[model samples]
Target: MTRYVMVADLRRCVGCQTCTAACKHANATPPGVQWRRVLDMEIGEYPDVRRAFVPVGCMHCADPPCMEVCPSTATRQRDDGIVTIDYDLCIGCAYCAVACPYQARYKVETPRFAYGEAPTESEAQRHEAGRIGVSTKCTFCVDRIDSGVEQGLTPGEDPEATPACVNSCIAKALHFGDLDDPDSNVSQLLAENQHFRMHEELGTGPGFYYLWDRA
Candidate 1:
C-alpha cells in the first residue's frame, strides 16, 4: 500500500505565502477559507527575536479523527492516503470539524465570492455546487495526482502532477511523494533529515512532516 505524505523544510521556507496563493487559486476557495497557510512564529527574546514560518493544513492523518467522528461517513481516506470529504454525504453538522485538531475542516452555509456576493465568471467556473452546507478541505491535489499517474507521470517529480502549493513554492520548501517507497524523494528526505510531525502524541500518525536543522 502506498502512503502519500508531504514535508516542509523549515530551513528553506521564506514565508512568502506563495503556497497559500497557489492553493486558493487552484481550489477557488472563498474569501475567509484558506486551505493552506504559513504561520509566522517568533523565537528567542524580544531583542534577539527571529522568525520561522510553519506551513500548515490538513495533515491527512493515518488515523483520521474526522473520519471517525463523521456521522454520515462523509470523510474517507483513500488507499493512497489522501483524506477527502464527500460533499453530497456531508450534512454540515461540523462534527468532523470539531474532531479535527488541525482545524482544517470548513463549512459554509452561504456562498461567497472574492470581490462581492455575486460570483464572477472565473469564480463560478470553479465553484463546487454541492460544497455549500458541507465540509471541505484540501485533497492533496488528488485529481492532479490520479490524472498524472494515469498518464504515467511522476507526481512529486513532475510539476504538472504535483500539488499547486508544491509547484508554486519558490523556496522549494515543500515536497510531496509516496512515503511507502524507500527510493522516493520524501522517503529519502526524511531518512536524511531531522524531522518531526505535528501532534504525534495524539496518535493520529500525521503524514505531514516538518524538517529542520538538517543532519
Candidate 2:
C-alpha cells in the first residue's frame, strides 16, 4: 500500500511557474493540454484587492468519480492508488470529465497552441504524428513513475529522474512521497499543517491535500 502524495506549501509558493514548465517538459504536453494549471483568485474590493494563486491538476481521488461514471470503464484506480484512464477506450463522450469535480480529463483529436507564435508545419506534422488521437491529463507521470520505480528513483529526485513538477519548483514548495510512510516528507508535512483537500464536501476522498497559507 505504498501511496504517494503531493503536498504544496502555499505559504512558500511564489508563483514562479517553474513547476508548470517542468510538468510540460516532462510530459511533452501540447498547447491546451496542461497537467498543471495555476489559477489566480482575486479577493476583497477593488480598493483593497488581493490575489491568490492555486496550482491545480488531478486530485487522483480515492473514490474517483471519473472511475465510477466512465461508461467504457476507461478509468480506474491502480494498485498504487493512482487513478488512470485508457484513451483507446475513451470515446470522447466527456462523461468522465463532467463527473470529475476537478474537471480533470480532456479528449484531443488535434493538439495545437493558441498563444505565442504558431508552430511550423513540420513541427505540427511531427507532434500530430506522435499524438494526434488521444485523451490526456495529469498522469502524475505514470510512465515516468513506472520507469523510475523500476530503476529505483524516488518522486523528488531531479534532473535525470524525478517528476517534472517536483524537480522544477523554484521555491521548492512542492513535495511528493509515500503517504503511507509516516517518515516520508509528505506525511510529515500533513502532520504539521492544518491541511485541506479540495472540494472535500464532494466526498471524492482525494489522496492529494494542500497546506494553505493563513488567511
Q: Each model's TM-score?
A: 0.97, 0.86
Q: Clashes in model 2: which pairs?
A: none
Best-performing candidate as measured by lDDT: 1
Q: Once superposed on the true structure, which residue ranges of model 1 sit more than 4 Å away at CA?
A: none
lDDT of each: 0.92, 0.74
lDDT string, candidate 1, 99-191, tens digits: 988998888889999887899999988888798999999899989999999999887999888999999999999999999999999999999
lDDT of 2 by residue, 1-215 (tens): 78866788776777777888878767666767778876767889979997766678888888888889888887878877788877667666777778888876766676575454676555454454334554557877777778887787765444344567877788777877778888877888888887899999999988777788442
Where model 2 places Cα greater than 4 Å from the true spot, the runs are 46-48, 113-134, 157-161, 213-215
Could you tally the backbone clashes for each prediction? Answer: 0, 0
Instruction: Show the colliding residue pairs in model 1.
Output: none
User: What RMSD, rounded to one decimal, does every model reach?
Assistant: 1.0, 2.9
